[model samples]
Target: MSDETNNEGLNEAPWRATILTLYPDMFPGPLGTSLAGRALENGLWSLDILHIRDFAEGKHRNVDDTPAGGGAGMVLRPDVVGRAIDAATGEGDMRPRILLSPRGKSLTQEKVRSLKEAGGAILLCGRFEGVDQRVIDGRNLEEISIGDYILSGGELGAMVLMDAVVRLLPGVMGKVASGEDESFESGLLEYPHYTRPTIWEGHEIPEILASGHHGKIAQWRHEQAVALTKERRPDLYEAWEAEE
Candidate 1:
């Protein structure tokens, strides 16, 4: 049996997301498929895909132009991107507006947690060199980066950010605890997970797992997760220390 939108399930909270991109069709096949798709298909969320080119001037539907001052890559026209943003969030109320740029502030779990408000969100996916500076400044949008590296387009970055934040919204996950214990949830890497076999080809399950001491096992996992995070991402460890 499949839950292809049951009437009772429609009663589940459905969040709304509006993505402003030149390539709306790029999405949704597999990229944001995990939690994002389930949220959309089951009516847990509604995704509004807006094509920036649709709002363009001519038959060419141009959305970008060469950057002024002579840059290697073109800069997306400010007016086009800004108009798309406005359409997505609407002029009614203020929402957390995000401009995806490689040079922007690095995305983080805490940042994702901050946008958990039930209000709608608008994501601007820039292409070419980047969106025009005038657009970013004029909109006063918060800039976010998935990592230090650069990608050809902002659509992938937007999807990553959207998936992360949307899952945090209330009622997205079928299981309430799904997002609560994942890696980075507690500023720590996730502890290892085990499944049914108990014993694999060359290894046996950890003895403590079979000890039945639930409290002790839980404490052990937390300590291990913290240690792993400390080893892998020193930045997270430093932030944890600052908080402590």
Candidate 2:
């Protein structure tokens, strides 16, 4: 059975996310708790969980089968996943259909912003070995990976993706500029941040921070962000340099 968890009094045309997965209960888990959760409750966005098993045929209601050509794990059937995709998206839905996979392009801030602007997304979580290649291509699903490592399933990746996108939705964050200087927003890792207790463990907050000069503080932050990115992510640093 499908579960619709949209709150009452929703904003007209709020961002929508429809997740297709065997583990329907996994959704809105973390997405239902923090800033994303608050936004969900305020009707800034909506979530619909579609159980892939609901589309399976046969008395056993099996959705996966032994991988063809011999493999250790079962592969999600194209027919079953296809039916689920079709059910989630009707004619002219226009929202991007995404399949979370390890081999897909790496997820990035730019991609997250694009998704936010796209209005919504339909995420399909692959379990076991993965979904059949035919359905991935046939359904026009764009695969995305959160990192180089692998997870047991795509549910976590889907949540990660949703969290990144939801926080960018207008009115979700306390301040619009709050996201402006974050890591990757400017193609660099964010600079270090400090709070209360100016002097801690014999180490005082950087003098430049307390100088009361906004211009110098901005300069210091940018330099720190550049140095940090260059040291840890030379690839990003080079790309950022090239763009400049």
Each prediction's total of clashing residue pairs, residues at least 3 apart in sequence or on different chains, is: 0, 0
**lDDT value for candidate 2?**
0.92
- Residue 234, candidate 2: C-alpha displacement in angstroms: 0.5
Cα displacement (angstroms), candidate 2, residue 81, comes to: 0.4
CA lDDT of each prediction against the hidden true structure: 0.76, 0.92
lDDT of each residue in 129-154, candidate 2, tens digit only: 99999999999999999999989999
lDDT of 1 by residue, 50-108 (tens): 99987788878788888788869787898888787777765465667888888899998
**What ranges in model 2 sit over 4 Å off?**
1-12
Lowest-sum lDDT 10-residue window in model 2: 1-10
In candidate 1, how many Å is residue 30 off? 2.6
Evaluate candidate 1 by giving its C-alpha RMSD to the native, one decimal: 3.1
State which candidate has the highest TM-score: 2
lDDT: which candidate is best?
2
Evaluate residue 153 in candidate 2 and report its C-alpha lDDT on the 0 to 100 scale.
97
